[model samples]
Target: MKTPNMITKSLLLSAALATSAVLCANAQIKLNSKTVGAATKAVKAVTLSNEDVIEYTKEYIQWMDEHNPVAPADDEFAIRLKNLTANLQNYDGLNLNYKVYLVKDVNAFACADGSVRVCAGLMQAMSDNEVLGVIGHEIGHVKNTDSRDAFKSALMTSALKDGVSSQGGTAAALSDSQLGELGEQVANMSFSRKQESIADDYGYKFLKDNNINPWYMSMAFQRLLDLSGGASEGGFTKKLMSSHPDTQKRVDEMAKKATKDGFEKPTS
Candidate 1:
């Protein structure tokens, strides 16, 4: 009675109807509380105010200090950092605080909340002027609002999705696990080439303001390049140079700036 094509069309319609009915029946699947909370926090991260950023950054820095081995006042690393940063306590309206992390990693970072952590390994690898050069660069990120931007990006990740509070009055207290994840994200964060260049200019000016030669900027990068065996492909070297402009280019630029500014490159 029906043609073969009509029969086939009828069978296909029946299958489509069955699939739609199944989907409709399962459309009311429930989400657990954790899923709901994470979604809410993700939304909060997107809407975080400047005050919220500082509060959360404070909490993150506290967590970092608790987890890392901060050098005591009597420690050589602590004394050295204290001396080097004595004049930087109130830099550019920032009430900065400095601490040395007794870690083997040659790294340093500055937080938006005026927190700066320098690793002992970096100090060991660099002279006082070179270390100041590095610290100046870190501070430049804070002064340029680069740290705040980087922190916001870190908070946007799924790992830190549950890290912020959903409340409006204050930043939500993060758990140890959330704080740890946030720390990891911040540590691995990288800046754009433009941001890096701006920070470099800030560092150069910072040194000149402190009456120190800007040659150390080039020296610091040269030391890092040597430590990387001139390879930026992988390992700690990659992390140090992560998403940055070319290392040699940075070295050359700093050298040129120093020369133009009437600072001689130190030869030893």
Candidate 2:
């Protein structure tokens, strides 16, 4: 009973039990912890809350609909956009509520909480896959919390109130058009080219991860590049105004990454 073999076995069993207990402890840590909760939630908390973004965007769009000629598409567009975004985003642990405005501008943006707003003009300009690429780029912005950072920077640099509503900061008591100026000011916000690269990296990661054709994003950017020299068609102003890199070069880089990452096209 006192043999060395018996003692060795006992020690081995004890060590194995200890290791198992340690692992279980590690694995059982709360999924709701700061690092492990919903990925989108982290984006919101660190950058901007989705709820606030949605509320503000909704109110802003509603006002725009009333004051301007633009209106959001019928529910059908929302349904289609949401479906398309969900399919692509499922791979990244993110989702979105896509909205299309009947504006003539070629711009699209995503707010925190996956609120994606696209101009009808932008929608009409690209193929479905190309549009997915465009949306993926904006999703990169949302994931990177650019909207929050950009909005904050805009607010800091301006003397204007937060919005039309009496929400944040001192009131300038400006009229609706003046408030619109503030909105444009906020929207015109841009980050360094570094930020644009980061957004591109995120976009690439998303495309590669999701098994969507990674080249689509690149191709979409190429389209932007091709359109860059023209009269802008006015509707293309927003896309042109974005502080992104030369679309053609970005497209080439994305293609290279897609190849390096071994991205396989989704069958179907």
Candidate 3:
């Protein structure tokens, strides 16, 4: 009894529903494989001293400031982030610095030297508390020395790129140019699943320490899950989950932590 146009709409709706069902199924089973990331080639471990880490991190921060276009210090997002992170600065001899980049990518990161960079797109996508949760996770990385491992991984990878080998765990000092190249690599380095889990624990603890709603951790992950289209099927599957494992598991863990801390579940 339906007209031709009405029948066409019905078919489209049915097709969409079918696609959603398939995506849901795929999401459940997609992360079962142990190896998830695209980069698989192993790099031998290289050791860098704490002095080396500090110097290299400083240079890397300088290079980023010089090369990348950052949001103006007075810009709304920059100011907002500065204010939000104010309380986290100057604690335990760890002086944290915060900056906002005008990049379109929805990302935020922290370095071993306590430099935090937040992208404008990420701020636009996440709420204030969610942003705080992400910042806390990054701070956790620095606190747990995960950033040190990431830097070492990057240096090792760069050594391969430069055709250099280490001797007895004491490698040649990277040249300024090589260090710059290594810096770039370190900037993009992804932490292991264990490191991320530790960072998540730190984030939850940070929320509690600052009298913030611990549920923000769950809210942040849920926001990411939603932004990734509620399934591990597209860009989210390829990028975010590729580096970080088990998005849904992370969300569930955060929810459990929040509930354990006597916080209500985040609805959104």
Candidate 4:
């Protein structure tokens, strides 16, 4: 039995298909079937409202707090992290919030609610500019709405499988435990290669927009490659290499981009 919302969605999809057919027949420039299909799918996908997204974000933050309490805003590392992310807030009218985890992992992530989480180890390992590039990459995820997609996808999957709620239900339908599981799923998600590449490009634009040396993007990747000992695969190296583009390839591209943009390499 299709729910009322499901029926409505089905009708919308049918309409989209009909419209695509008409457009294809009358179009001056031949429309690619793949492009039309992608556009139709984008319209058909079910997504949560902004209010529900925020609710999920708050729940996920609470769960993270329980499992991995954030470093205090006044902590030394936290202060530096804040300083690093300060410039990012005013970009494109986005007032992003920053937090530092006391964890030792060399990773960072962002949330749909404009929340940015940086690991203390990342702060210690990279220079401020290098750290900024990483944060820029994370910000790219939020700016690109990848974070929102991840949250919506995770919540919808859980709701359907776990009977948490209907597609249109408010966030209140999810229990704390279910929200916790959703958060865990979100944290572990590996974004698609295309998405990763887009984020990297966004990060580049971010650094250039702020008048920061964009070469740090290459430097950051090179640093990781060196840390990984340029291994073909294994351990952290595997994780880094498996992230969409090859590590060395990305490093070379960033270097080429810097030169093309008339940004000179730093004197060492």
Candidate with maximal lDDT: 1
Worst 10 residues of 1 by lDDT: 12-21
* Model 1 agreement with the true structure over 1-268: per-residue lDDT tens digits: 0211111100000000000000112123222234346677788778888777777677656655655678999999999999999988989888888888786666677778888777787899999988888777777778777787677666677476665654646666666555445555554556667767877788888888899889998898789899888866432345445557578988899999999988898873
lDDT of each: 0.66, 0.46, 0.57, 0.56
lDDT of 2 at 216: 76
* Higher-TM-score candidate of 1 and 3: 1
lDDT of 3 by residue, 1-268 (tens): 0111111100000000000000111112111122222232122223446555555456445545544557787899988998898787864466877777676556666767777777677799998888888777777777777775566556556643343233344343334455344544543445567766887888888888888888998888778788877764432122234446568888899888788878886555
Clash pairs for candidate 1: none
- State candidate 1's TM-score: 0.82
Q: In angstroms, give how far residue 231 of model 2 lies from its true place.
A: 9.5
Number of backbone clashes in candidate 4: 0
Error of 4 at 27 (Å): 56
Q: Over the stretch 1-268, how does candidate 2's per-residue lDDT look in tens digits?
A: 0111111100000000000000111122212222323443333333433444334434333333343333444465556566666665443555555556665555566554444556566676776676777666666665666655554333334443222222232221333443344355544355456656776777666665666677777767666666656232322333332454345566678777777777643332
- Give the 10-residue window scoring lowest on summed lDDT in candidate 4: 12-21
| Count of steric clashes across candidates, in order | 0, 1, 0, 0
Q: Which stretches of candidate 2 lie over 4 Å from their true place?
A: 1-82, 86-95, 161-178, 230-245, 263-268
The per-residue C-alpha lDDT of model 4 at residue 156 equals 57
Error of 1 at 148 (Å): 1.0
- Per-residue error at 30 for model 2, in Å? 41
